[model samples]
Each structure stands twice: as structure tokens, then as C-alpha cells.
Target chain A: MKSNTYKEYIAPVVVLVCICLVVTAALALVYGVTDPIIKKNSKATADKTRTELLKDADSFTEYKGKLVVEQPGAVYVKDVYVANNKAGFVATCVTKSFGGALTMMVGVDKEGKVTGVKVTNHADTPGLGTKDFEAGYLSQYKGIGELKATNVKDDGQIKFITGASVSGSAVHYGVYAALHQYKDMGGVK
Target chain B: MGKQSRLRILLNGLIKENPVLVLVLGTCPTLAVTTSVENGVGMGVSAMAVLVCSNIVISLLRNVIPDKVRIPCYIVVIAGFVTIVQLLLQAYVPALYASLGLFIPLIVVNCIILGRAEMFANKNTIFDSALDGIGMGLGFTFALFLMGSMRELLGNGTWLGIHVFDKFIPGMGIFNLAPGGFFSYAVIMAAVTYFAAKKGAK
Candidate 1:
């Protein structure tokens, strides 16, 4: 009776072990096949965004060490990326919005003008705050002449999306920071 | 299980016992991935593939697993399948994989896979369990596609990457935002529930 019980239990254990081994091998095979594709796609996405912000640049290189760019009335830069010939720089900036942290990439021309801005990530309230990033509103930054945080009435002054004050301010701060970084790099006018 | 009765069991999961709507078993993916039709379909198909494959393996091994360690053993089995699905999505369907994001990994925790493993697969014949899995998976996919279509249409004025209502409507972009998802989901859920209740009443 004891021998029979042992044999019965051992049989199931062997079967279980075999099944697990096979399943693991299969998963490993699939993972091996797909890992490279995922990595490639991620790189492509980053490159696309970088290109959109620095259209005139031939190449871009990440600036190492701590570099802060600040115009007289703008925010500070968290990091900087210099494009070819110092024509412009991309800076990372963050601000508090209604939903959560709003992060944006701000591009500034050599003359300290706002060249472009892209909201890289944000948790802002979707409909109200998110619209601030819509092409119509964001495109206004294309030729913004200079970084002036307090000149709210200037035609080139940052415009707030009526209902999304927090999100608007976040983008405003981000752009301001980028302008400051550009000037500090001696690339701003 | 009777041969004919086995078919009934399979059909029952497709509609009467749907993992998404009827059973409300996998709400996380249902809510998270249904933002667009493409994403919803991608996630649905990936999950179905994993579920069906796992169910087959689980059923075949049921007799071998000791009851005490069955739950843990089942989890390992399910996780293995989930990873395989994740990798496949990442490779061949990069766009869909990006849209699905972490949700693909979250499939490991989806109750539908584990629930079927515990309830249907463990005790059933291999063929029957496989059918049950396919049926339930299809039901979940159908639900996701319906939700995705509504959200995409209302949120972005587009469907399946095509701008269908663009010519007919101006300023129809409100639906593409986040609040639109909530409103659309509520309306669709209410409608499905009402029809389901009405059918039951008859």
C-alpha cells in the first residue's frame, strides 16, 4: 500500500515538472524573438519627437552635467540637448497641473525665441487641459519672439487655455525654462 | 461531460457567461485598453491567444497537479503564457503593443485566465476546456471591440484609424479626450444592461 501511494504521487509530480519545463521554454522562445523589435520601436518614437522639435538641426547630442538656462522672467531647465551649431536647445521642464505633473519639451532658437513646444507627458484633466496641446494652440509658439514671463498682454505672450489654468501655466513655465537654458548656453540672443 | 452538453458549455461562455460583461471578471483591461478600436482589438486578440493556449495546457496537466499547490502552479502556467503573448505583440505589432503598454503585462493578473483555469479547465476534458476558452475569449474580444468603436468615434471623430465623420461634422474633437471615455463607457454599459434585462424579462 505504501509503495503504491508513493508511485501515484511521484507520477503526477513528474508530469507537473515536465509541463512547467515545456511552458518555460516556449515563453523564453517568444521573448527572445520579440525583445529586439520592442527596443527598436521605442528608439524610433524618441527620434521622431526629437526631430519635430529641432527641424533645422542636422544632429543632436545630449548635454552632460548640470546646465540651467534661465531668461530674466522664465523658468529653469532640468536638462539640455544641443542641436547642431547651437542653433537651438531642447530643455525639459515640469509644472503642477490639475491632474498631476505636466512635463514638456521646449525648443528655443539662438535668439531666445520660442521655436516650438511639445508636451511629452502629462496627467492633466483630459478634455480641458489636454486641448492646450492641440496643434492650433501649440503652433502659436512657433515664432514667439522672446521669453517674457510677465508680459501677459503682449501678442506673443503665452495664452492660457481658458478652463485649464493649471495646465496652461505648466506649459508656460516649461517654455520659460527652455528660453532661460538657451540664453545660459550662449545660444540665445 | 456529455458531447452535446460540452457544446452548450462552450456557447454559454460566449454570451451567457462572458468574462467581461456577463461575469465582469476582467474589468481592468476592459477599462484601460478600450480607448481606441485598434488598441482594444489588439489587446483582445493577444489575451485570447494566451487564454486559449494556457487553458489547453492546464487542462492537460490537471490530473498531474496536486490540489494543495494547484493555485500557485496555475499562476506560473498563466504567467508563462502571458509573457509569450506580450513578446509576440511587442515584435510583430509594435504600434498596438505601444498602445497597450503595461496592460500586456497586467494580463498576468487578469482574473479571466485564472478563473477559467480553476473552474472549467481543471475538471473538464481537454477539448471541452479548449472550446470554453475560445468561446469566452471571443466574447471578451467582442465586448472590447464594441467599447473601442464607441470611444474612438466619440472621442476622436475617427474609427479604426480612418476619419469617418470628419466631412460631416465640424469641431467634433471633444470625444478624443479623457472625459469622453467615461461618458461613452457609461452610455454603452447602460444600453447593454438594459437590453440584457429586457431579454431576461421575456
Candidate 2:
């Protein structure tokens, strides 16, 4: 009877615990080796993205101020980097889009004008939601000082893709959040 | 089961017990990642790595593991291998990692690995189980490659990002959608079934 109980309960428990320990040990070994390389790769990508968005800036330092944007879950500021050359401030903002969160970088100059805009990561629908993210569409944000309204229907400053309003407005709000973050920081201070 | 030779065990997964086309396991990643050849191949190879590793470990531990908690043991082992593959991909091959995205982590739940662990690995010797892993992995990869080629070629008018039919035949946009995935999967499944049936009759 004791042997039966051991087989039914104790044996399984011991086996499972041992398996868990071995798996965890293996995972920790792999993670320790790969973590640094992953971090380096992402940092390199971020640096490259920063240079692309703010062409004239030679270097950037992350803005130290706390981001206090009160927008809902759909839009929020991720990070803001200030250009040392006074070119502009690059703001990374994530906004809810068609498929999922759309993360984009918007560079705003000291004069409160958009220098450039680039999408960093997004799960937006390909072909449809991506229509708004085209170089032609995103380029319109360049030289525009500020947005007056939330979407294309209200704000004539930006022209949206005909069938992708959700994505378009998502991007519009992303840019809005970035610009708002820039304004809140009061330029390169 | 013991009567089967090593070569037959290895080759069995290619057609008779194919995880994707014949058995129709892991349809989620099979459909989701096959939109592009690059993504499809990437996902296939990644999943194959996990499957092979998990099968070997599960086979080795089959005798030691208690039958009552074997499923949970298999899951922990499979999930461990998946994370290991995920980390390695992120560190070494960032491009493939980025393209594959959420599907990488989703491999943890892939039924093929668990199915093999339960069905083949536990019953077989270590060498035979490893061969099964390789055979099944190759079959899964081959299936994804075929589906990815068809979808990428028809939908994007390109093969592996190279412009193939673009100059002559315009891209069929529907082939890039979810419906297209199901359509292609069904068509290929029917063809495989037809040939498989013919072979069985012979």
C-alpha cells in the first residue's frame, strides 16, 4: 500500500521537481550567454533609428524629464531623446493600431516643426494598415509645426489612406503624442 | 514498434506521419508564417530545432518520468527548449527573429513536439527518437517551404523577395490574406491525400 502511494504521488512529484530544476538550469545558462548580445543588437538598432530620424544630429542624449502625457491606453510616450547639435528631439511613441501597438519615432525641431517620422515596430495589417505608413504618407508630417486635431477627417494637415482610417488615426495619434511630449519637455532644455 | 528499422522510423515522418500536411498538427504557425518564404522557412527551422532537442530529452527521460505527470514534464521540457531557441535566434539572427515575432514564443504550444514526446519518443530508443525528430522536422520544414513558395509567388509576385511573376502576372492580393492560407492548405492537403491513397492501394 505504501509503495502504491509512493508511485501515485511521491514518485511523480519528485520526477517533476527534478525535471523543473534541470530545465531551469539549462535556461539560465542559455539566457546568460545570449542576454548581452540581444541587448547590444537592440541598442545598435535604436542608435541607427535615431540617426535616420534626425539627420543633422551627430549625437543624442535621452531627455531626463518625466513624461506626464495623460492620454489613454491607446497612445503613450515611450522615450524622448534630445539632439546635442540642437537639431531636434526624437520621441518614440506607441499607439494602438489595427493589429496591435504601432511604435513610431517622430523628430521635432526646436522651432516646433516635425523633422522626420519613422515607424520602429508595428503589428499593423499588411497592405491595408501599412498604407498609412508609406514613405509618401509619413513624409507629409515633415515641416508641419503641430497638429490641430486628432484625425485626418478633422485635421486637414495630414492626408490619410482611404480605407485605413484606424491605422491612419493611430499614426496620427502617435505623432500627436510625440509632439505633445516634445512640447511638454519645452524643447531641448 | 520495435520491429521497425532505423531508416524506416526516420523516413516515416516525411509522408506517412507528417506533422503538418498528413497529421495537420500546428496549423496556426503553419498558416500564419507561410505568407512569405523567408518567414515560413525561418519558423520551420526554429520549430525543428526545438522539436529535435525536446524529443531527444524526452526520450532520454522516458524511463525515469512517472506516467501520471508525464504530460506536465513534457511541457516544461518543450517550453525550455523553445525559450532556448528563442534566445539564440534573438542573439544571433535578429532579422529572422524580428520577422518571426510572436510566433517564436508561440512554438511552446505547438502540438507536434508534445505529440511526438508522448507517442514516439517515450516508446522508442534514443537514436530512433532522434531520427524521428529529424524526419518529422524535415517534413514540417518541407511543407512550410511549399506553402510559403506558393503564397509568396502568387500573392507578392515574387519568390524569396525576387520579382518573378510581377512583370507578367499581377499579384493576387487575396493569396496574402487569411482565406488564402486556408485555401492553399486545403488544396495541398487534398493533393497529398490523393497521392497517399494511391500509394496505399499499391
Best by lDDT: 2
lDDT of 1 by residue, B1-202 (tens): 6778877877786667778777878876677667678877877877787788889989998887887668878988998877777677767886766555446676788889999999999998789888988888888888888888987776666788699785576434445554665666578667777887998999
Model 1 chain A: ten consecutive residues of lowest lDDT = A147-156
The per-residue C-alpha lDDT of model 2 at residue B59 equals 93
Tens-digit lDDT track for model 1 on A1-189? 887776668755765687689888888787777778777875676567767887876677888755663332234565677776767767777655565666677777676777778876565423345668776778777877565662333325666655455566667666666665665667632
Best by DockQ: 2
Off by over 4 Å in 2: A68-74, A97-102, A111-115, A119-172, A186-189, B1-4, B92-96, B99-102, B167-169
Query: Model 2 compared with the native: what TM-score?
Result: 0.86
DockQ of each candidate relative to the true complex: 0.26, 0.52
- Per-model RMSD to reference: 6.5, 3.4
Worst 10 residues of 1 chain B by lDDT: B170-179
**Colliding pairs, model 2:** none
DockQ of 2: 0.52
> Given candidate 1, what's the lDDT at residue A36?
82
What's each prediction's clash count?
Answer: 7, 0
Worst lDDT run of 10 residues, candidate 2 chain B, spans: B97-106
